[model samples]
Target: VREEAISRSRCFLNSAMAFTLYTYPNNYRAIKSLIAAEYTGLEIVVPDEFKFPGDVRSEAFKAKSPVQKVPVLETPDGCLFESNAILRHVARYRPEANLYGGPFYEQGLVDQWLDFSAFELEPPRNVWLYPILGYMKYDKRAAGKARNDVEKALTVLEDHLLLRTFIVGERITLADIALGSALIAPFEKVFDAKFREKFTNVTRWFTTLINQPEWKAIVPSVSLCEKEQIPAFPKKKEKQPKQQKQKQQKSQAKKADDESAPPPKKKEKNPLDLLPKSEMDLDTTKRTFSNNPFPAALKIFYDAWDPEGFCLYTSSYNYNSENTVDYQTSNLVSGWLQRLDSLRKYAFGCVNVWGVEDSKGPFVINAAWVFRGPSVPFEFTDCPDSEYHQLASVDLKDEAQKAKFEALLGGAEKYDGQPLYERKQFK
Candidate 1:
């Protein structure tokens, strides 16, 4: 008995204190501990002792975790279950590294974000994900609610990360590792290209975490979700009895008759299709802008210009109306532009600012715009009107139009007698 006890002790402490992690392979929650182990430089051996045919409820496995849950970690001291608990244990072992943080307050922040990730992020993500994978029955309302919850959480997270590189401090921490692991399933399954684009800050934070050596050991590569998953619904049951079928058919027919039939389709619903047919060579003009020299762009603009179908205009932000902090007001313009991005296919603008902060009588903001319609598209005008703006239409056929156009195109150093401070293009 003495020899056997010494042998077990030897097995537990080979090289660097061998710890065993019990989890089903490729489990996301299990990844938390794997990453923590990597960061703490601890060896955590994943057990293959229980295979599919073998039972997880076997006496040996159950002895470690009463619930037969995966990701139970066995240290020489004792068995640690729960992924988050295991992460805390591993990180605290290397407390001098400050994985959990020091100074009391920093550790509290890590704990708060860890809990936020679990409650706010993980559950809703599962609701949105598992149903699509056929792991749970798909309910449209439930999926929508789950998606809304996730977007809400992500929006809050985006704001937190907008000014910082990492979640807590300058570098990686338990907050990031726990949240990164929690997000992996959704990143791989539902956060497709379009969805990811909406939360640029979150994408930046996630990409940074996964590229580190600690994360790469477990998740070597992650493909941003490209295709949205469709629910795998069970087929309708067939082979109904004739009397029962007739009853169901009668019910459906009566319901259909009661419902109003949809109106018949007409022409397609593209806004560009609404224009009176034109013989203008617009496509060649656009192609020139894309594929040809600068001179060709000028030629196309001059030769193919259609005054009846398109309009030229200039506008400036009501700069004097703003509180006058440079970066804040600049962000206002950027946010407005983001809101206006949907109109990109129909609009182009050269928006410029002049003078330094509080310099030369409240820096002027001017935009030279070319829009596709006679009047400004509703999309541009739909935004709340600001009294600070000065808007005017420019007729290209006017005698001085060429000079005005040239000045705007060059992003003029002086527009209306003010020196240029900055110029941003909307193309």
Candidate 2:
């Protein structure tokens, strides 16, 4: 019966139809599926309209993917989410490709490696690379531990690949696709020559995989890391107290009349200070939200909100696929909010990290901002950390958009059917 079921499955795949894959550009998860398609001759269409977080957040996309994540395979039968599952679906299209391996035991081995890739390899890889790539804030101690973990995982692979050409068998299987794709970011970003020296076997195996025609077909180039890349730290600004600032002004005034004194410097005004007052009482709104539950807080917020004087905007982290560790992602949000301190008087916002951490997360980030202007404040956009976010103006007139904003602001346990992992309010 088992054998018959397997035969039936293969028969169905043999006549497999085309699939549309929804994903963002340079998504490694999509790469795995594409590479598998190359091997099995599966037609996977990635629609140009299916963009990043926006499309994924739409009602249509949510219907297909309740969790609202990507690498969703739209098949004639139904839709499939999750990259590994999509890769496996593509791989099974041509039984002759043997991407899942032939014998039952070999198939089990492939599954093992795939599980290993996800459980052991990918987590450390993400932890190590995310910081360097600026997706997560750099933490010396966390990074050090992550590097050690990656080294240990690679050591295991090194021994396994010592005498074998591929992970499971002589031919490339889903295991190779999983592990190879998992390592691509690390090898290109963090695993420098010095680091690669110890894992000669794993390096050789990885090199062989990328050089293959199928890999080359999907991924035209693979640039191995030569020198280690370091994270760029932000500079901190020191704030002086009012009394200290007044004393400094007095001291500077005395220097103004001196023979060698330079001309007084003009004080630069904030661009936002020039805007007409919104009269929204943002501080009161923040306090109301903090002090009361969702219903009462929302009522206070709605009463104070002046659509003509203020604007609502939404933003999501572009590199959320790299958001693995809960603490690290929280820190990423913290860092951004800290930089946004200058906007306290002019902005009220909520940043939510959806999906739990320490799991397979391409965690989703949803942020809602209410600014005392017609658009996003310059101070918010001017920050270096702002570049990683995809910003869009929100139309509260649209009920759906308004509800999403409310969810973020009210600290809802779930948004668009996905559970909220953490929420931070910026007042």
Candidate 3:
């Protein structure tokens, strides 16, 4: 199936320099390209799972495009990695599309705003908002800085839109698409009723442009909560009663003492403590293990010992057909074993597995997993075996550490059948 998809994609290689977009669904840059493609009547195919440039570290992708970022535009002439570059290329292809602008200088203005949208606006919003919304992961200090920077940018945008209808030209152009994508983040996640109310012009401009038929073709609808009034930080209140004030002072004194005192060392629990507590005694009559016990055990292992940093999927099994059952069960077991084997080395903290059911059948599927870091959900997969095998790359990163993790899994005294997991070290 994978080979067939790749072969079919090669057909694009022959045509007017096929445009392939490597993007994730929620990615702002990817969405920008999607909007551009829609306006230009171009087709852009996005890969299912988008790995971070650092994560994949693929030499081939890097060689073709130095930046190694998503929303990559692959053409017969050359590969363009950045989102803005791809948008420009698509716009230039259909100059009559009116997505860029009429005059050459107008196009330049649109380009200027596009640059500002990416460099000036998007970065700050991503830094501040992505972490808070649990999209990307970052430290608290970094997240705080991003939040402040995003607010400053928002205020600037608000000021600019006070009279202007659009960011660059009167008509919707490349600038609107670029800036609008970034702006959607704030409107969807950050701006409350109060903030929108305060920046009425910005709100009006955003509403007018995003609702346009062209933009809607790509973005569909910008997700937003009801406009909320921005409340003052550390809200004001009336003075408390005398007794309440006294109690607060006492609590503050205790807090100060706790802060000044040396932290107590924690005694680690026995390795056995890692396993889940004994299952509650349930009525077996209600839910008997109909199929092989292995499937249930596999499900339990995935549910418990999921690797901390990779995605996972469950396999479906068939009882009546030996060929189907054997192939499915073996693949499922092998996948699980491989993942367990990998985590024994470059140990992450934990893995999350999501179960997938069949489209229409009595056969309930127990397959699906998404690996999450402590901070962000990184990888996702529908193929359990593929995700399981991919763990080897992680294991190979540190041999000694991998061995230690292997010992934990193999050490019958500790893991038994429980899936062992770990957390990554944070800076």
Candidate 4:
């Protein structure tokens, strides 16, 4: 009781210090802020809105994050974007928090790896990963080059980790935070058993980071890709007329390609200037016009911001994933959408397949949606709890509303999971 009271008092004296990080999860870029907050003991809040479209692209959001990139830190001093900048800001938030390395030379080491993590690791990692996750079109030639690039970065780290427990000195530094987060997707999606066996030192270092309490606080699960995935479809053997068989084969192949692809590109520019001046400030407005036109790709990629009347929710197959049979997982999505008949008026979403259906081991269900009411009813989120591994609304909305509305409508293009399962529309 005494300790609780003292902690409350300490918080009170700090001017109600609170931070709202604007971005989505399982995002490596956002991890630096989340991990830094743990070390600094800073109170940070991520607006439930990230699950939707528009938060980062909105006029108000752009006002703070001019470049419109995420993991933006909303601080009392003002807004700070760029993941590295946020990491630096929070690491220095409480001088007592020794996240930034000590001594001039130690700091240089931290900066060195920070650069290596962002430049050396992140680019190739994204090229290698985004294609697999459907975030980008899978161009075999490009992906091959990307894999080679990633191997080069991993080689650098293997030599470094061979000597140190952490990426830097005695404690976890910005280097570990940055590099660890960047590695998550690649590890989960591509680095398989044989790959890890070859990089023994890198494996040891990864295990150390994954086990840290601070690391687990943000990332609950870290699984290595048991095998590398290839998204193309296999040949069919069923008997049919030659023309019919060829047509069927082509259709199925095209379908698989569509469901397994991600958004085409990143729209870094904010399309709007002053969102139509409303007497009401940003928090309450319903309609916001973009300063310029939103390309379909932009609408698809940047479409999500938390939308009013909506909450983002994700679900995964609840049963033993080991029991999964190829297209059976996609059929599960088909069934879920069929079951979501009642939500037509209130929801718009897409069901994504993270890995290739026949070869991709497990399938997770994702939906970025909005409700007709302030919240999603328990019936939708909790009733059939056992049927889903997860179901929760994270938020997004408006220039205020236009962007959110378009984003919800655009999920089909963004996730574009139609080819994986039969695309269903309740509306």
Candidate 2 structure quality by residue, lDDT tens digits, 206-268: 999999888998788999999888888787888999999999999898877565866689999
- Residue 403, model 2: lDDT of 78
CA lDDT of every candidate: 0.72, 0.81, 0.53, 0.62
Work out the TM-score per prediction: 0.52, 0.61, 0.48, 0.54
Residue 84 error, candidate 2, Å: 3.8
| lDDT, residue 374, model 3 | 27
Candidate with the greatest lDDT versus the true structure: 2
In model 1, state the lDDT of residue 255: 92
Q: Against the correct fold, how does model 2 do in TM-score?
A: 0.61
lDDT of 1 by residue, 309-398 (tens): 777887766334222334334444555676677667777776666656633235556677777777777767665432235577887667
What lDDT would candidate 4 get against the real structure? Answer: 0.62
lDDT score for candidate 1 against the true structure: 0.72
Candidate 1 Cα deviation (angstroms), residue 348 = 69
Ranking, TM-score, top scorer first: 2, 4, 1, 3
**How many clashes show up per model?**
1, 0, 22, 26
Candidates 1 and 3: which is better by lDDT? 1
